[model samples]
Structure formats: C-alpha cells, structure tokens
Target: MTAIAVTIAGTDPTAGAGIQADLKTFSALGVYGATVMTALVAQNTTGVQGVHDVPAEFVRAQMRSVFTDLDVDAVKIGMLSRPETIRAVADGLAEFAARNIVLDPVMVAQSGDPLITPEAVATLRDTLLPMAMVITPNLPEAARLLDADPAGDEHAMLEQGRRLLDLGPEAVVIKGGHGTGAESVDLLVTQDEVVRLAAERIATRNTHGTGCTLSSAIAAGLATGAPLASAVRAAKDYLTAALAAADDLRIGHGQGPVHHFHALWPNLPGEKR
Candidate 1:
C-alpha cells in the first residue's frame, strides 16, 4: 500500500512553513500528502504580517472530509493559532482514531514573531499533548510549554523532555538549534531511553521552516512503517542536509527557507546540490 500522511497546519504565503512546508517535506520523503488549513497567514521568510483564522467548526469539517476518505498513515500537526482551533483538531483526531501523530508545537515564527496566543498554547499543551505519538519542541517552545526556564545544557534538556513525556507523548524531541553550540543536538527522549542526534551546525541565516519540515519528515517516515527512533534519525539527517544547502536559494530578505529539494536537485555550477 502507498504511504499517506496528512498535515494539519496553517498557510504560509512564502511556502516556507506551515502546510506548504509540510507538503514539501512529505513529497520529498516519498509520501502522499494531504492538508487541512487552520489559518491564512499573510507572511513570508521575513516575518508574519497578519493572520486570519479559519472557524473552529470549519476546521472540524475539513478534518472529517479528509479522514473519511483517506486511510491516513500518519499526521503532522503544526500551527493552531487559536484555542478553539486546537480543541477542534484534538476532537477530530479522536473522532477518526488517527495514528502516528507528530506534533510540532509551533509558538513563534522564525522571525521572532509570535504565531500562537498564550491561551492557545495552554490548550495545545493540555488538550493535544497527550494525544501525540511524538512531540517536537525547540528550546524556547519547550520552556513556554512547561512554564519554566529554558534548558541550557544536556541535563536540563533531558529533565525537561522527561517532564514533557509525563504529559503523554510516547517520545519528546528537544531541538537544540537555538542554543549556542558548534554542533546542534536534538535529544529524543522516551520512557526507555534518551537518544542524542547531532549535526554540525550550518552557518546560514536561512532556516525558516525547520521545525515544520522535521515533523512532517517524521510523519512521512512513520507512514512508511519506520520505528519512532529511526524516523527521527532520518528526519534529522534530511534537515541537516537541507540546512547546509539553504544558501543555494535566495528566497527573501530575512531568513530564507531550507532547501527542501536539495537531494533531488541536480548539482548546478557553483551551487551545492
């Protein structure tokens, strides 16, 4: 059977994040992609200018429409800008009995603009956290979700991951991209063990939709029947290569997106393919 993954996320006009990025990641990983949009965001790689949210009931309707027809193998959930939107997604997931849910708790944009409200964040942490198979949160996002200080070191990151694991996800991946280090590290924490995945930090300002891409890649892997750890490892490797090749494309003034098609694109003159 063909692997299918659905992305329930917002819209990014620049196609760097949200549903657009999710679909790109899914296709890059050879998974069939579907989407449910929660918001129409007027933004780009520079920053988010404005957001118009889809009604909660409409969000539910979209989910129902997709879930009924598609035998979705995995789901990658991204931005839910409002509290009601979060609730609606949670309810719909239960209604359909979705599996292999990869939750990326997106709170802020790459430009430092806030994408979700405090109330919505609380709702996501409370209502949706427990339903996720794996939750991926960067340093600041983990701190915000826990209502605690950001984790500074490996020990602190593990402690925070453990706390998040208690909230119901089978595993938690704490991304270390925001931290000051020569090599970026991400810790995958489960009840059984903690696996550290690291890569040489690429020196580029273009990493607009990294979290969205990683989560969607994981969903693609899961849709293909890979184990959680294997999925995560593969996703990390893909993202690292994409980041390394980000400068190959000039998308916008601010942080450009990672090269989602880096591996497939032909190696052109003076460009890293």
Candidate 2:
C-alpha cells in the first residue's frame, strides 16, 4: 500500500514554509501528501505581511473530509494561528484516532516574524502536545513553550526537552539549528534515552521552511512505518543535504528555501553553481 501523510497547516505563498513546504517534503521523501489549510498567509522569504486564519469549523470539516476517505498513516501539524483552530485540530485527531502524529510548534517564522498567538500556543501545549508521537521545536520555540530561557547548550537543550517530555509527548526533539555552533544539533529525548543527532551547521540564508520540512520529512518516514528515532535521523540527513544545496537556488531577496528536490532535480535551473 502507498504510504500517505497529511499536513494540517497554513499557506505559504512562497511555497517554502507551510502547507506547500510540507507537501514538497512529503513528495521528495516518496510519500503521498494531503493538506488542510488553516490560514492564508501573505508572505515571502522576507517576512510575513499578513494572515487570514481559516474558520475553525471549516478546518474541522477539512480534516473530516481527508480522514473519512484516505488511509492516512501519519500526520504533520504546523501553524495554527488561533486557539479555536488548535482545539479543532486536537478534536479531529481524537475523532479520527490519528496515529504517528508529529507536531512542529511553529510560533515564529524564519524571517523573525511571529506566526502564532500566545493563546493558541497555550492551547497547542495543553491539547496537542500529549497526543503527538514526537514534538519538534527549535530553541526559541522550546523556550516559548516552556516559558523559560532558550537552551544555550546541549545540557540545557536536554533539560528543556525533558521538561517538554513531562508535558506528555512520547518524545521531544529540541532543535539546535537556531543556536550558534560549528555543528547544529538536535536532541531526541524520550523517557528512555537522549539521542544526539548533529549535522554541520551549513552557513546559508536559505532556511525559510526548515522546520516545516523536517517535521514533514519525519511524517513521511513514519507513514512508511519507520520508528520514531529512525524517522528523525533520516529526516535530519535529508534536511542537511537540502541545506547544502540550498544556496544553488536564487529565490527571494532575504531568506530563501532549501532545495527539496536536490537529488531528484540535479540538472534543474539555478542549481548549476
């Protein structure tokens, strides 16, 4: 059977960070992808100009439309700008008994623009954190979720991850991409162990959709029945390769996007550098 994954997120006009990025990552990783848009975002690599959140009832209806017919194997959740939308998604997950849920607590955009509300953040923490197989948060996002200072080192990262684990996620992956280092590190912390996954911190400004890509990549792996840890490792490798190739694409003026099809489109335009 073909593996299928769904992304319940928002729109990114640049196709780099929200629903579009999730779908791209799914396709690149060889999984069928479905999307339920929660917002219409007017944004580019520069910054978010505006947002129009989809109604909560419509969001619920969209989830039902996908869940009732499709054999969704995994779910990748992204931006839910409103508390009601977060609740709607949480309820739909339970309603459909969704499995292999990977949640990316996206509070801020790569451009340093805020993407979610404080009220919605609280709702996501209370309602969805416990239901996910894994929750991926960058350093700043982890800090926001825990209401503490962002982890400055590996030890702090693990500590915060453990705290988040206490909130009920089976595992917490605290991303060190936002930290300063020779190598970007991510910690996969579960009740049993802490696994350190590190990659060279590629120097580039094309990281617009990184969080969405990584989370969706995990969803793609899980959709094919990979274990949580294995899925995370694979996703990391994929992102690293994508980042390495990111500079080849000349997209926006500010932060561009990772090359989702780096391997598949070797000879494509703007990649001949």
Instruction: Estimate candidate 1's alpha-carbon lDDT, on a 0 to 1 scale.
Output: 0.95
Per-residue CA lDDT of model 2 for 1-273, tens digit only, reads 999999999999989889999999999999999989999999999999999999999999999999999999999999998999999999999999999999999999998889898788888999999999999999999999999999999999999999999999999999999899799999999999999999999999899899999999999999999999999999999999999999888898889999999899856674443
lDDT of 1 by residue, 61-100 (tens): 9999999999999999999989999999999999999999
Deviation (Å) of 117 in candidate 2: 1.1
Q: State the lDDT at 68 in candidate 1.
A: 100
Q: Number of clashes in every candidate structure?
A: 0, 0
Q: After superposing candidate 2, which stretches have Cα over 4 Å from the reference?
A: 268-273
Which residue window of length 10 is worst by lDDT in model 2? 264-273
| Model 2's TM-score against the true structure | 0.98
Q: What TM-score does model 1 achieve against the real structure?
A: 0.98
